[model samples]
Target: MTDDKSTIGQLPDFDTLANSLIEEGVLTVAPSELHGMLSGQLAAGARFDPDTLLRVVAELMDLDILNGENIKLILLELYQTTLAQLQSTEFSLQLLMPDDVHQLEQRADALGGWCSGFLSGFGLYAARHAKLSEEVTETLHDLAQIAQIAAESEAAGDEDEADLMEVYEYVRMAALLVFTECNPEPDDTDEKQPLLH
Candidate 1:
């Protein structure tokens, strides 16, 4: 756990990961979407070894040329940092998205993409498990609705900004909820409990 906490400090920023993917001509997924996908996987108990990690990234990015060392490094860092955040007791998970410099619509689009990616990743594993609680199902439904969100008007105003911030916080907490539900901590008996059955 301490090691995982230390690794959080090495997490790269959104722009750095986005730029690296852009440099490699990998635009199939945005940085926010990628982070969401990784979080979903971790929450659903999808542990990745090195080969599995590379394969999953290549598949998600639709990349045939994944041999680039720089891209690999950036992706590995993202994976480690995301897993650490999900496992931490501090509730430190952060969604990757455009900063305030970007237009409201652009940020909203990224959020939609992130939710879409999360559903895809989580479904890949959760489908096999079955029997999710009603709360989890409702959360999934909410996230699906949020995936369709867009800027309602052309000119964004202060009220719109406030609404977006509220939505962002909702999404952040939602991810943590899913993670906690899927990966409960071990008890003193040391028996691993089944998740969400």
Candidate 2:
């Protein structure tokens, strides 16, 4: 857990990592999108071991670009951290996304991709295995709608910035809600105390 947390905190620059994946011809989706997919799957109860996780990520990205040992290790650690974070008692939606310095249109595009990936991941299990509540269904619908958003370079005004911020927060909260609904906290059952011998 510590390793996972530390790695997450000290992650390499998003652009650098993304460029590496692109250079390797392996990154089909943006970093945020990839992480969203992984998180959605885990939250929906997909149990994948480290190797399996790596394989799935590679497939999602379109190839096994982890030809290098360091990349492989880093990705594995990220997967572990993501899984742990999803299952955490202090679970929160902390997307490994690009910084806010990017333009509004670019951010919107990235968000759309992330939403698309999230829906894909959630549907993987929710469609077949689990029974979704009405709320979850609605959330999924909302996300599906969001996935269709396109880049709109209107202006660099405060209102637009504020709206973008709101959207970002909405996505974050909506994801956390979905995760909570899918992975409910364990009920406290302590009717009988442990016997002290």
lDDT of each: 0.77, 0.67
Residue-level error in angstroms, candidate 1, position 80:
1.0
Model 2 earns a TM-score of: 0.80
Each model's RMSD to truth, in Å? 4.3, 7.3
Question: lDDT tens digits, residues 1-197, model 1?
Answer: 33455446545777888888888888778888888898787777676766668778787789865777877877777887787777778878877888899888888888887888888889877864567778888998999899876423345788888977888888878888887787767465323222331
- Candidate 1 steric clashes: 0
What residue runs in model 1 are displaced by over 4 Å at the alpha carbon?
1-7, 151-155, 186-197
TM-score of each candidate?
0.85, 0.80
| Clash pairs detected, candidate 1 | none
Q: Which ranges of candidate 2 are over 4 A from the true structure?
A: 1-12, 150-155, 186-197
Q: Supply candidate 2's per-residue lDDT for 80.
A: 65
Question: CA lDDT of 148 in candidate 2?
Answer: 75
Q: Which candidate is the best by TM-score?
A: 1
